[model samples]
Target: MTSSQIQVPAQEEGGATILEIGQQPDAWREVGGETDEGLARFLRGITERPGLRVILTGAGSSAFIGQIAAPALRRHLGCRVEPIATTDIVAAPRDHLEPDTPTLMVSFGRSGNSPESLATTALADELVTDIWHLVYTCDRTGELGRAHRDRANSRVVYLPERTNDTGFAMTSSLTSMLLSCLLTLGPAGRGNVEALAQAAEHVATLQPDIRALAQSGPQRIVYLGSGALAGLAQESALKLLELTAGVVVTYFDSPLGFRHGPKSVLDGCTLVVVYVSNDPYTRRYDLDIVAELRAQLSPDAVRVLSCEPIPQELGTATVLPGLAHLDDAQAALPYLVFAQYLALFTALEHGKTPDNPFPSGEVSRVVQGVTIHPISPSDLEAR
Candidate 1:
């Protein structure tokens, strides 16, 4: 059965539910056997065009997806790959777009209804002579998908039906979209996709363990990642904060970048979660930070969760495996699931509803209260 097919038991009043969303990683196995030929075909069409400069754009969580995908695409495709927030693109098109450039824009959206999302796509068409769009969205009938229908240079990849999550926070949708992108651009002829999917499923089984750790102690959380994973770190931090309704003060930093200034944020109450890379060069930086933190941090006061096992020198209190060899985008699935588990546990600890943590009504699943401005003639002429 698919992950979505598994029913979550109802939670007792003012108590944590036995069904942990973080374990969705284990459900990835259901998708493992399937081949992503559609995504591969789409990538081939985009890459075949000469002089293609690719822009991966999105907003909020979707923007974080682009950030993680950018580095991997640049390294593997040997093409210029940039991850730009749709908000930024809409506000300053000239800064991100080139009029004469042949561009392939990859957009990610959950609802695909964000105002900036449609505006950014329109801006690309208006400013660039040769612009092609690849939209990855969970909602098939949403604005982004509908906008691409009659357009010759545009294609929309609706995520698996199961990915259309009803929950306020994105869970399954994020992983499916990120995995689709990895298969689209990753090394060809290697069946690591199945392995990656299996790993995700395995992590799902560890949700209970993750929740236990998250509920143990440490009110402050710090996430460290490098390269493409840096975006994953940010997303992870945001997920914990949002799901817990800011019950946990969270921070994210690049492994090396953390030492520069952000390391000061780590203290006795901090729980440091590190997404270690398989790449040796990047892993060294991640390990180094862990080493420094260990020396200064009291073992009882600070909690450390590493995605992979570190040497004895780093002294990680908890290690979760099955992340090695996976790309940062794909690795993010298990890590995200773990964060969700932590958030839920933390929320329950504070007597908050994991489903709707912000009982005060400050935030909505779909953001509200933003006014969009029309592009002016002066803006066009400047480009």
Candidate 2:
């Protein structure tokens, strides 16, 4: 169903998430129109500097995008590109920051209002001498978004207007910003539009099936993947846990890691979703885990998402379609559509609103109650 078409109890209306999720295909197309020459020069600048370091920073789902992008981008740039959360940087700047190294702090935020996002940027300005900012956000109007638009070394990439999510949870906002980073980082992201278009069209057709599967009300959920998909797996887990308000127990880890101590969580009622990696080597481990889980649990217990044709041959497992034509980084957007739908349908099954999942005032659309304390000179010295 389209976002606006989703029906929930009057007390639990959640149209924002549904609409956000549905509009992602459009957001994918729209964000492509934006271009920043300064941002382009900064990317080239990284290659020219000998000791330059790139730090991809954000909070919550925004942070996960950094995890997904850093590894791929590091290889693409052939330099040190690290994914460190603004949450961590704000709390302990000494370990993550260095005044001697030329640093580029790439900040990803949905609203750009979170105290830490800007606070972390501020900290960089104070502690690092040769610091630059490349900020990609859905809301160019928010405090962090507008704060540094004129900085000589900084570049702000404001995505399509529709991407600034009105929903409590980030749907288009998350994927679009993540896609933007991938698009900026390397060749892998350059070909994403064609692949994302196909995947979006494909996902639109599968919503009914996905919704039906989610209504079964599995008591527990597990998401597994390898490489960049591993980070997306964590974001998916967070989406469900937040939407369900902790009513459902969820866990995320890599396929091989699941076998170590985590495999005990599996049971008859547990639904396991595996994001089959686009990498051939990683795909083998993913398939192996699926085989093991299906053999140990029922074949019905495990679900695999992949672009591989061979998964169709696995009779015991349910295979969700993926965009195999795109590389892992470029294809992450389409693969994430499945996770977004799962969270949406799962929340609705319980008559809960996916948009504003938590009314307890405990969790919020924007993180609240944060105290951005000043980092002292003493704190700057690494212990």
Candidate with best lDDT? 2
Evaluated against the true structure, the overall lDDT of model 2 is: 0.81
Clashes of each: 4, 1
Per-residue alpha-carbon lDDT of candidate 1 for residues 39-67, written as tens digits (9 for 90 to 100): 56766888877778999998888888888
Residue 324 deviation, candidate 1, in Å? 2.9
lDDT of 2 by residue, 185-304 (tens): 765544457667667768878888888878877989999988888888898899888888888899999999998999899877899988887788888998888888887877677877
Weakest lDDT window of 10 consecutive positions for candidate 1: 11-20
Reference-based TM-score of each model: 0.89, 0.93
lDDT of 1 at 70: 85
Q: Scored by Cα lDDT, where does model 1 land?
A: 0.73
TM-score, structure 1 vs. true = 0.89
Q: Give me the runs in candidate 2 sitting further than 4 Å from their true place.
A: 1-14, 189-191, 311-313, 316-322
